[model samples]
Every structure is written in C-alpha cells, then in structure tokens.
Target chain A: MSLVFDMALVAGLIALALHVVVTRDGRGAILAFMAFGLLLGIGWARLASVDVALTEAAIGGGLTGMLLLRAQAHLVRHAAHPAALPTDRRRWLVPALSCGLVTLALAAVVLAFPRPAPSLAHQAVASLEATGLGNPVTAVLLAYRAIDTLLEKIVLILALVGVWSLSRDAAWGGASQLRPAIIPEPLVFLARVMPPFGVLIAVYQVWVGADLPGGTFQAGTILAAMALLVMLAGLRLAPQTQSRALRLMLAGGPALFVLVGFLGVAVAQGFLSYPEAIAKPLIVGIEAALTLSIAGTLALLVAGPPDRAPEP
Target chain B: MSAIALTSASLFGLCGAALVGIGLFCILTHPDLLRRIIGFNILGAGIFLVFGAVARRGAAMGLSGDPVPQAMVITGIVVAFAATALAIALLRRLASLTGSATLEAATPPRSET
Candidate 1:
C-alpha cells in the first residue's frame, strides 16, 4: 500500500516536471515549476530526509517562486512573443535524441546501484556524540564538514553582491522596493498578524535544530518569508543596499564562523575543530549568527538590486 | 532495506532521470533566458533527487538516510537559490538594457521591435 502511494507521488512529480518544461508561456512554466518544487519536497520526505524536505519547501518552492514571479512581472513589457518565435521541427530532433540518451544512461546507473551501498552514516554517527549535536546531519554540517557550511555562506554573500552590482549608478545605495504599488487590505492584515508567530517558529526551528531536523537554512528562510510578507503589504520597506547595519548582518555569520575556525587551530585539533568541552555552545553560537545573516541575505536577494534613489 | 523501500527508491530515481531529460531538452531548445533558467532549476532538482535516492540506499546504523548527503542537499538548495536569483537579476538587467530577453544568435542582427 505504501509503495503504491509512493509510485503515485513519483508519477505526479514527473507529470509536473514535464508540464513545467513544455508550457508555452513563461508564467505558466514558473507556476508549474513551483508545483514541481512542492512535489519534490514530498518526494524528499518519502525518502526520509525531513531537513532537506523543509529546505525544498521553503527555499526551493516558496522563495524561488516569488523571485520568478517578480521577474515575470518585470519582463511582461519586454517579453518576447512566443507565437512569433520560429519553431522548426528539425530544431527539436538533436536535442530530443541527446536528452533521451542521457536519461537512459542515468536510469541504467540507478537500477544497477551496488547492492550494499557504501556510506558514511556509521562514521558520522560514531563521531556525532563528540560534537554534542543530537542530529547527525547537524554534526556533519557543523562538525565534520564545517568548511562547506562556511563557504556556502560566502556564496550567498557573493550572489547578493552580484545582484546589487546590477543596479544603475543613480540607484546605488538605494532602497529595493519589493512591494507592488497597490496593496490589498487582507494582505496587510495577514502581514501584521503573521510575523509574530513566524518569528517564534523561526527561532524554535533554529533552537531545536541542534537535536532535530530543523536548522539554520530552514529557519532563516522562514524569517526571510515573514520579512517579505511585511514588505509586500507595505508595512515596511527593504533596507537600503548600502546600509551599514544590513551589511553587518549579512557578513556577521560567516565572519564569526571563520574566526572560530581559525581559533580552532590553537585550541583544538585543526581549523573548524571545536574543542570537545565547548563544542555544543560554539556550534549553537555559529548557528545563531548564521540564521540572522541568512535571513538578511535571502530577503535582500529576492528584493533584487535597489531601484530607487536614497531619500535625501 | 525492505523490498518495498527499494522499489520506491528505484521508481523515484527513474522519475528524476526523466525530469533531467526534459529539463535538458528545455534548456537546449528554448531561446528565452527565463525558460532556460527554469530548466536549469529543474535540472538541479533532478540531480538532488538522484542524490537523495543514494542517501536512502545508504540508510544504516538505525538512521532513515545518510545524514551527510541530506546535509549536503540542504546546502545545495540554498546555493542553487542564490544562483537562480543572480541569473534572474542578470536577465532582468539584460532585458532593461537590450530590450530583449531571448539569447538567440544574432545572425541577421534583428532589431528590437
């Protein structure tokens, strides 16, 4: 019975992905892509990775959908006419055959996967207790592979820089107005009411993440979503791109992580190697800073480059 | 692992394979930058799903899946989002400046309408 349900779910995922690819209109494709992300989240849950499922739902489906929709609206005036584009039959043949071959090769590899798959689960679990993290995933992220997490934070910052650099010279150091000019009453009402609860949940997710599936990424995404909602409803505006506080918030997490990592060289085994005595608190400290930075970076990423001149 | 679980993993894996194919086709054939970006995301999702299946197969020591890969997937999702945002921002800027979103080769040097 469970297998049947899983099969159906996989079928639904495939159908949605196909729809996303084949849809004629860009807007339609984006909507389908969002649905595809949600289904992919469910697929992750079925595979028993709840942490990934949360990230998929929040960042993959939710934030990405918003970004794409904003882009769609922006491009509506300049968008190419799909009907006017030439669609020759011969243009499809090579791509279709090559894609088919790639799919078949991948499917073959999947079916032929080793019977006793090699894994790091045992190694991860064995060393997990030393890190004082209940969640093995957390241990792997913050303890075993701290460098990856640190670098990922840098990637977010770089992406934000890339986005801000796109702004015109006059708009530099200005506010990114994410909200539409017109606001509806119900949205304003929800924005005012939802954030308090969202804040609580975001904190809870980060706090429990040391021992559970929740973590900095999921928690930060929730916080970003709440901020976006408030901005969309005109309750607040995105911070100016060049605000010192905003820049500090964006850099604090990674800077702190790197500082602690270098400290490990003198205090522990190597860089990022937390001393056993203070491991838990140290990891938690890093996560706290990371959550704030991630929230700020994500919100600003979606807000795009500043569009308006700074208020004189 | 249970036979049922194995079967489900394989099924999902195949589904991911198909998604990768469709996304690849879309990326190759579509001229519109937005569609290509969407296709790139689909391609990424497919790759993550395949990795998820690998993690599931590695479930042992009383864990549901390999925590390392799961952690990696979470990180991958964030990075992918950042890349998508950058791409879209670049696309928007390109459209604003060039007044065109399609990236087809300008053989005839078509003028912006």
Candidate 2:
C-alpha cells in the first residue's frame, strides 16, 4: 500500500512537470514550475532533510517564483508579445537523447556505489573534535575544504556582478501597467505571521549547525526569503546611488571565512585548522556573518537592478 | 519496511525523474525567455528530489539522515535561486533591448553576407 501511494505521488509530480514543459503560454508554465518547486520541497522532507526542505520551499519555490513573475510582467509591458514556442524537430531529438544518456549514466553510477567503502567521510566525521565545529558537514566545508567553500562564495558574487553588468544598459522605462497586482489581503496577513516564524527557525538552524543537520546556508536562505517576500509586496526600497552597503554584504561571507582561516593558520600552524581551544565560539561567529551575507546576496538578486526596484 | 520511509523514497525518485524529463523538453523547445526560466527551475526541482532520495538512503542505514549531503543540497538550493534570479534579470534586459519577448527571435547576429 505504501509503495502504491509513493508511486502515485511521484507520478503526479512528474505529470505536473511535463505539463509545465509542454505548456505554450509562458505565464502558465511559470506557475506550474512554482508548483513543481513546492512538490520537490515535500519530497525533500520525506527524505529526512527538514533543513533542506525548508530551504527548498523558501528559496527554491517562493523567491524564484516571485522573481520570474516580476520578470514576466516587466517583459510583457516593454516588449512585444513572445512568439510561439519553437517546434524544431532537431531540438526535440537532441534533448530527448541527451536526457536519456544522462539518466542512464546517473543510474549506472548510483548502482555502483559500494556498500563497503574505505570510509573517508566517516573518518572525517569521527575526527570532528579536531575541527572545532559541532556539525560534521560544517567541519568539512570550512575546516577540511575551506578553499572550495570560499571560492563558491566568490562565484556567487561574480554571478551577481555579471548579471548586473549585462542588464544595466537596457533602458526599461517604468511601464505603470507592468506592476503585478498588489499583495493580496490574505497573503499580506500570512506574510506578517510568517516572517517572525522564519526568523526564529533560521536562528535556531544556525545555532545548532555545529551539531545537527542545520547550518548558516539553510538559515540564510530562509531569512532571505522573508526579506524577498516583504519587498515583493510592492513596497519599494530606495535605490542607493553608491553601493557601499551592497559591497559590505557581498564581502561579509568571504571576509569572515578568510579571517577565520587565517586565524587557524596563526594559532594552529596550518591552514584552515581552527584552534582547539576556541573552535566552537569562533565557528558560531563565522556562521553568523555568513547568514548576514547570504541574506544580502539573495535580496539583491530578487531586487534585480538598483534602478528598477530597491529593497525597502 | 518502515512505512514512512518506504513510501517517501520511491515517490521522490519517480517524481524527480519526471521533472527532469519535462524540464529538459521545455528548455530545448521553448523560445520564450520566461518559459526557459521556468524550465530551468523545473530542472532544479528534479535535482532536489535526487538529493532527497540520498537522504532517505541515509535513514534506512540506521543513521540519522546524513547531514553532509543534506547540507550540500541546501547550499545548492540557495545557489540555484541566485542563478535563476540572475537569469531572469538577463532575460528582462534582453526583452527590453530587443523589444522581443521570445529569445530565439530577440537578436539576430550580424553576418558578412
């Protein structure tokens, strides 16, 4: 019976996704896409990653939905109606063959995972006491592979810069008709109640990240969602002529990450080796900074241009 | 079989694959910028489902759902959001600059004919 039900849900999810792809109208497709995100969140929760589920729901569904909707609205007013979707035969065949190959490759790899391994990940977990962090993943991300995490953050910043630079020159005069409907009354009420809860949950996740399956990235994503919701309600933030605060927020994560890594070098005589004496407290501080930075980056991404809209 | 575990794992795997297939089709066929963004998001959702499956595997092993993979998935989710937002921003700019909402029709590269 459980298997039957599981299969049904999975099939439903797949059908919905296929509908989104096949749908010709861009607006309808986006709505279906948001529904797909929500379903995926439930799927994550089923897998025992409540932390990931929350992040997926908030960031994956809520924020992405809002941004796409806004862009759609903006385009509708400033540009000609989109042409009919392409129907090239080669396009269909290429994706079908490529997806098939990718799926088969993935299945082959997953099936090959050994039941018994040399257990390097386990060894890393067992030796977590030396890393000064309570969460094994945090220990891995910051202490073991600090360079990778640092570079990832830099990639994020660079992505934002690239997008901003590309879009800045396009003159999009305000189309009064382009504004999305005002935040609905029920949605407004829900929004008010939700942010505080989101804040509480985000804080709890960050604090327990040292020992549990929670962390700054998940918490920060939630926090960013709360802010994104408030901004999307049509309350515009004033644009800063100078991006001093933006610079600060963008630098916050990598700066804290580098500072902590250097501190490790100074005290432990090795790169990224946090001092055993004060690992927990220091890790907490770094996580806090990370949360702040993540929230900032996500908010700016949602806001798009400093010229179009500002985060109030 | 733990009822909850048995049900959720299979459901996630099936749903994830479906999403991936549809998303791929949309991405390849759709010329509208908005539709492409939607497709990109669907693809991300499918990947999230895969992560969920791995987490369920951790549970069946009698350990708490492994935090490492979960953490990485969460990171990926946030990054995906940023990427989607950036893509939408670019799409809007493209729309405005070319005054065409469909991407394939938006710009025609110059030729030395």
Candidate 3:
C-alpha cells in the first residue's frame, strides 16, 4: 500500500516537471515549477530525509517561487514582446532523443546500484557524541565538515554581492522596491496576521535543530519569508543596500563561524574541531548567529538589485 | 532497506532521471532566458532527488538516511536558491537594458538583399 502511494507521488512529480518544461507561457511554467518543488518535498519525505524535505518546501518552493514570480512580473513590464514559443519542428527531434537516452542511462544506473552500499553513517554516528549534538546531520555539518558549511555561507554573501552589483550607478546604495505598487486588501491582512507566528516557528526550528531535523537553513528561510511578507505588504520598507545594520546582519553569522573556527586551532585539536567539554554550546552559538545572517541575506537577495535613488 | 523501501527509492530515482532529461531539453531549446533559468532549477531538483535516493539506500545504524549526503543536500538547496536569485537579477537587468527578454531577439536585425 505504501509503495503504491510512493509510486503515485513519483508519477505526479514527473508529470509536473514535464508540464514545466513544455508550457508555452512563462508564468504558467513558473507556477508549475512551484508545484513541482512542493511535490519534490513530498518525494524527499518518502525518501525519509525530513530535514531536506523542510528545506525543499521552504527555500525550494516558497522562496524560489517568490523570486521567479517577481522576476516574471518585472520582465512583463519591461519587455514589449512576450517570450516567443518554440514553433520549429526541426528543433525538437534531436533534443528529445538525446534527453530520452540520457534518462534511460540514468535509470539503468539506479537499477544497478551496488548492493550493501558503502556509507558514512556508522562513522558519523560514532563520532556524533564528540560534538554533543543529538542530530547526526547537525554534527556532520558543524563538526565533521565545518569548512563546507562556512564556505556555503560565503557563497550566499557573494551571490548577494553579485546581485547588488547589477544595480545602475544612480541606484547604488538605494532600496529595492519589492512590493507591487498596488496592494490587495486580503494579502495585506494575511501579511499582518502571519508574521508573529512565523517568527515563533522560525526560532523554534533553530532552537530544536540541535536535536531534531530542523536547522539553520530551514529556520533562516522561514524568517526570510516572513520578512518578505512584511515588506510585500508595505508594513516596513526594504533596507537600503548601504544600511549599516543590514550589512552587519548579513555578515554576522559567517564572521562568527570563521572566528570560532580559528579559535579551534588554539583551544582544540585543529581548526573547527570542537573541544569535547564545550562542543554543544559552541555549535549552538554558531547556529544562532548563522540563522540571523542567513535570514537577512536571503530576504535581501529575493528583494533584488537596488532600484530607488539614495535619499541623501 | 527492505524490499518495499528499495522499490520506492528506485522509483523516485527514475523520476529524477526523467526530470533531468526534461530540464536539459528546456535549457537547450528554450529561447527565453527566464525559461532557461527555470530549466536550470529543474535540473538541480533532479540532481538533489538522485542524491536523496543514495542517502536512503545508505541508511544503516538505525538512521533513516546517511547524514553526510542529507547535510550536503541541505547546503546545496540553499546555495541553489542563491544562484537562482542571482540569475534572475541578471536576467531582469538584461531585459531593462536591452529591451528584449531573449538573446536571440536582442541582436540587431539584418537587412534583406
């Protein structure tokens, strides 16, 4: 019975994906892509990766859909012509054949996966106690492979910089207008009602993440979404790019992570190696800072490049 | 993993494979930059699903999946979102500057002989 349900889910996922690729209207494609993300989240749950499922739903579906929908709206307003649909018969055949072949090859590999698959689960579980974290995924992220997590944070910051650099000279250091000029009453009502609960859930996710499936990425994204909602409803203004407090919030998590990592060299076995006695507290400290930084950075990224001139 | 679980894993894995193919087709054939960006995201989702399947098959020691890959996927999802935002920002800027939403349409037209 469970297998049947899983099969149906996968079928739905594939159908949505096909629709996303084949849809003529750009807006319809994006809507299908959002649904695809949500169904993909369910697929992750069926695979038993709840942490990934949460990330998929929040960042993958919610935040990314928002960004794409906003971009689509912007493009519609700026471009005189709508995107042209591919109508040439000669263009279709080769791509279809090649893609089908690639799918077949991958499916063959999946069927032939090695038995008694090699894994790091035992090693991760064994050393998980050293980090003093209840969640093995958290231990792996913050302890076993701290450098990747740190670098990923840097990538987020760098992407934000790249986005900001696209702004025109006059708009540098200015605020990006994220909300549409005309706002609907129901959206404003929901935005007003939703954020307090969103904040509570975001904090809860981060706080429980040390022992559960929730973590900085998932929680941070939730916070980012709430901030976006508030901005969209015109409850608060999107920050100017040069705002001192916003810059600090964006850099705080990564700065703290790097500082703690270097401290490990002086106090522990090596860089990012937590001393057994104080490991849990240290990891939690890093997560707390990271959650804030990630929230600020992600919200700003979705807000896009600065558009309004500076208020000086 | 049990037989049922193994079957389910492969089913999702195959779904992922088909998605990658579909996304690649869109990226290669679609003229619009925004559509291509969406295609890139679909390709990414497919890759993550494949990773999830690997994690599932590696489940042992009472864990549902391998923590390492699951952790990696979590990180990958965040990074992918950042990349998508950057791409969309770039596309929006291009549209504003060039007055065209697609590369093919952006070029100057040739005069008939």
Candidate 4:
C-alpha cells in the first residue's frame, strides 16, 4: 500500500510540475505551484523529515504562493492576453533533450550514492544531550549548526532590504496596504475567525520545537500568514515599514543572536556556545526571538514594499 | 551495498532528479519571468528532495532520518522563499517601470496599447 502511495504521489508531483511549466497563464501556474509545495511537504513527511515538511507546507506553499499571487495580480494588467508562450511547441525540444540527459545523469548518480550513505545522524545524536533538545534536527540547527542559522537569518534581512529598496525613495518606509480593491466578505470573515487559532498553533509549534518536529521557521510562517490574513481582510492596518516598533521587531532576533554569540566568548567556549546547563533555555530564547523577526519579515515580504506614503 | 538502497529512498531520489530536469526545461524555455522564478523554486525543491532521500537513508539511533540534512533542508526552504520573494519584487518593479515582464534587451519595452 505504501509503495503504491509513493508511486501515486510521484506521478502527481510530476504532473503538477509539468502543468506549472506549461500553463500559459501566470496565476494558474502559481496556484499549481502552491499545490505542488503542499504535496512536496507530504513527500518530506513520508521521508521522515517532519521539520522540513512543516517548513515546506508553510513557507513554500503558503507564503510564497501569496507573494506570487499578488505579483501576478499586479502584472496581469500588462498581459491582457496571456503572453505568447506556447508559440512553437517544438522550441521546447532541444531544451527538453538537454534536461532529459541531465535527469538521466542525476538519477544514475543518486542510485549509486555510496552505500550506507554518508551521514551525520550519529554525530547529531551524540551531541543531542549537550543541546538539551530531544529533536536531533533542532539540535543540529541551533547547537551544532548555530552559525548557519545565524547567517541564514541575516540573509533574510538582507533580502528584505533588497526588496524594500526597490520602491521609490519617496515611498520608502511607507505602509504596506494589503486592502484589496474589493474585499470579499468571506475573506474578511476568515480574517476575523482564523488568527486566534493560528496564533495559538504558531506559539505551540515554537514552544515545543525543541522536542518535536516544529520550529521557528514553520511557526514564523504561520504567524506571518495570520498577520497577512488580518491585513488583507482590512480588519487591521498593515504596519508602516518605517515604524520604529516594526523595525525593532524585525532586527531584534538577529541582534540578540549576535549578542548571545559574543556572550558565548565570555561565558562558554566561543561565539554561540551555550553553557551546557542552560543550553536549552538559550536555544529556546533565541528561537522565540527569531520567530518574531521571521514572522514580521515574512509577512511584510508577502505584503510587499510599501505602496503609499504614511499620512502626516 | 545496503539493502535499503533499493527502497523508497532511491525511488524518491530518482523522482527528484526528474523534477530538476523539468525545472531546468521551464527556466530555459519559458519567456515569462514569473514562470522562470517558479521554475527556480521547482529546481530548489528537487534538490531538497534529493537531500531528503539521503537523510532518510541514513536513519539511525532510532531516528527515521538524518537530523543534519533535515535541518539543512528546513533552512534551505526558508532561504529559497526569501530569494523568491526578492525575485518577484524585482520582476514587479520591472513590469511597473518598463511595461514588459520579459527581459528581451534587444527589443524595446512593450508600449502600452
């Protein structure tokens, strides 16, 4: 039954992928891609990567889909008719042949991946006690691989800056207006109904992440989604990008992460090193702060750069 | 060779390889910037799937998969989203300024009808 399921999933995944690639309309392709993300999340779960599954489903499917959908809506005015994409089907032939060969090579290589597949599972497990985390993946993320997580957070910040800078200088630091031209009654209702539950789920995911498959990324995404829903529903105003409180929230996680890293040098072995006795608390603290920053960053990212200047 | 090598891990790994191919084809053949961005994500997901397969095959210590790779995949997914958002931002900016979504440098920007 399981093997059959996997086969069906793979078939479905491939079909959706092809659909996204060939769909002439941008919105259709994006919606298909969102479905693809959710399916891929399930695929990750099947592979026993629960953390990855959550992240894929949340960020990959939920947030990215929203971003693309909004962008598509904005750009559709330019393409009254779908862009001339399917002109010559034969044009895909050469590229298709090339991609086929690449796939063949990759498949052969994957099949031959050294038996017993080189892995860090044991090392990750061995160091788990030091991190005071039950989930080896969380341990790997916050303990053994602290620097990567730190740098990744900074990368997100930098990307947001890049995104924000694209707006006109006068509109810089303006408020993100998520109000659609005509708000649907259902969306407004959803916005009112959903956020309370979403917040609780997000908090639960982060709080228990140290021992489970949930973590900051997934939690952050859920919070981001909820925040977006509220703003989109026009229940609450989207915060100004230049609001000091918003900026502080956006940078606080990484800032604390950096401070903690430097504190490691004074208190423990080196940067980002936690005293074993307090490791879990420290990791969780960082995660909690990071979750807030990530949520704000991601929500604003999807809401996109500020469009209108703040009222005087 | 491990007996498990012939299991679902290998199957999904092969599946991932196929996705990478499809993504590459989309990126190369599609004229639309939006489709190309989506293609980039498909490519990233394929690579992560391959990583997932590796993580699963290495399961040990009562765990179902390797923690290290799973952590990496989680991080990769977030980063990929960040990059995608940036790309979409750039694309929208291009569309607003030039009135064209595709970057055909030799040709003039599409004039508003």
The local distance difference test score of each candidate is 0.88, 0.67, 0.88, 0.87
Best-performing candidate as measured by DockQ: 4
Worst 10 residues of 4 chain A by lDDT: A78-87
Across A217-289, the per-residue lDDT of candidate 1 in tens digits comes to 9999999999999999989887887788889999999999999999999999999999999999999999999
Q: Please report how far candidate 2 places residue A169 from its true position, in Å.
A: 5.9
Model 4 / residue A84 / CA error / Å: 4.1
TM-score of 2: 0.82
Interface RMSD of each: 2.8, 5.0, 3.2, 2.6
Off by over 4 Å in 4: A79-86, B1-6, B105-113
Q: Across residues B36-91, which tens digit of lDDT does each residue of candidate 3 receive?
A: 88889988898888788889989999999899999999999999999999999999
TM-score to true structure, per model: 0.96, 0.82, 0.96, 0.96
Give candidate 1 regions above 4 Å deviation: A82-86, B1-6, B105-113
Over the stretch B1-113, how does candidate 4's per-residue lDDT look in tens digits? 45544578887898899999999988897778888999999999989898888999899889999888899988898899899999999998988887878764533223321
Candidate 2 regions with alpha-carbon error over 4 angstroms: A84-94, A108-113, A116-121, A131-134, A167-194, A234-243, A308-312, B1-18, B51-62, B105-113
Pick by lDDT: 1 or 2, better one:
1
TM-score of 1: 0.96
* Chain A TM-score (model 1): 0.97
Docking class of 1: medium
lDDT of 4: 0.87
